[model samples]
Structures are given as C-alpha cells and as structure tokens.
Target: MNLVLMPMWLLSGSVFPASEAAGWMRVVIAINPLSWPTDALRGSVLGEPAGVFAWAGAAAF
Candidate 1:
C-alpha cells in the first residue's frame, strides 16, 4: 500500500516525511496483528468469534 502511495505522493506536490510515513505504516500494521486465526470468522454467517470458541470447545471435550 505504501508503494502505491509513493507515486501518488510524488505527483501530488506533497509527501509524507520519511519518519511520518513509517509511523503511518506501523499504525496500519498494528491494527491487524493477526495473532489470532480470524480468517473468515468475523464476517461469516456464524457471526461470532468462532476461532476462539472452537478452540475452547476442542479443549473442553
């Protein structure tokens, strides 16, 4: 995404300073840690934290 942004910034007569750009990238990454296997979980019809609940169920029995 930053690669995409770079060309636009060059054309726009403006640029995010290097330090600010890196900080923006870090914020984007931090929003999605991916520490949990949340694939297709939040938007699925099940509409619950299925990954966590499924793990708990497997451990319970």
Candidate 2:
C-alpha cells in the first residue's frame, strides 16, 4: 500500500502546529515500522505487510 502524498505543510500550513501558513506541500515519505525503507534490509525488495502504529490494526476489511 504505497502512498504518494504531498507534504502536509505544502497543502496547508495547518498541517503543522505553528508556522507562517505558507501552504507549500511536498512529496514526503510516510512509512510505518512494518513497511519502511531501512538499511537493515538493504538489497531487499520486500517488506512486511503490517503497520507499526499501535492502533493501526483496529479494524480490517
């Protein structure tokens, strides 16, 4: 489940807590512990299908 989202700051200054509200979003990498780009798994093209967030598995389809 790859996500291609622009940085919240760019979309809306409210994304952050305190800022000038410039509203400049960018494509930032958002990864969970289970699926992240890590050096430990160098040279690997696979990742665990899970989320590291504590409440990530609250529900399932």
Candidate 3:
C-alpha cells in the first residue's frame, strides 16, 4: 500500500508546487480526488482562493 500510494501522494500536488510540477504531474494532480479536499482546507485555513472546481469537487465527494 505504501509503495502504491506514495507515488500518488507525490503526484497529488502535496509535496511540490503544482504550477511548477511537470505537465504529466499536473494532470495527475488534477484528477486526484485528494486534491480537492486538500485545496479546500488549504484555502480556508490560509485565506487563499481555492478555485471553484475545488469546492465543487469537494462537494461532489
């Protein structure tokens, strides 16, 4: 499980800046279900703008 999920975590835009990540990495992050909640929490706590998609995705989840 660690082996399988570690890569997903790495590619989930959690460890690195999504904008600076490679194109493929960004694509992976975009589809990652974890990103929405992470983004929402980050936005709420940090007063950052979590995109509409993030809210919608989190709501959908």
Residue-level lDDT tens digits of model 3 in 1-61: 9987788778766687789988877888989887787788789989999999889888987
How well is each residue in 1-61 modelled by candidate 2, as lDDT tens digits? 1242343222322244223333332222132222232312221334434343322422220
Steric clash count of candidate 1? 0
- Encode model 1's per-residue lDDT on 1-61: one tens digit a residue: 9886555434321233223446655454333323112323332545755465444433443
TM-scores for every predicted model: 0.21, 0.14, 0.74
Give me the runs in candidate 1 sitting further than 4 Å from their true place: 15-61
Models, CA RMSD each:
15.0, 11.4, 1.8
Question: Which candidate leads in TM-score?
Answer: 3
Error of 3 at 1 (Å): 1.8
Candidate 1: C-alpha RMSD to true structure equals 15.0
State which candidate, 1 or 3, has the greater lDDT.
3
What ranges in model 3 sit over 4 Å off? 59-61
Model 3 TM-score, 2 decimals: 0.74
TM-score, candidate number 1: 0.21
Clash counts for all predictions: 0, 3, 0
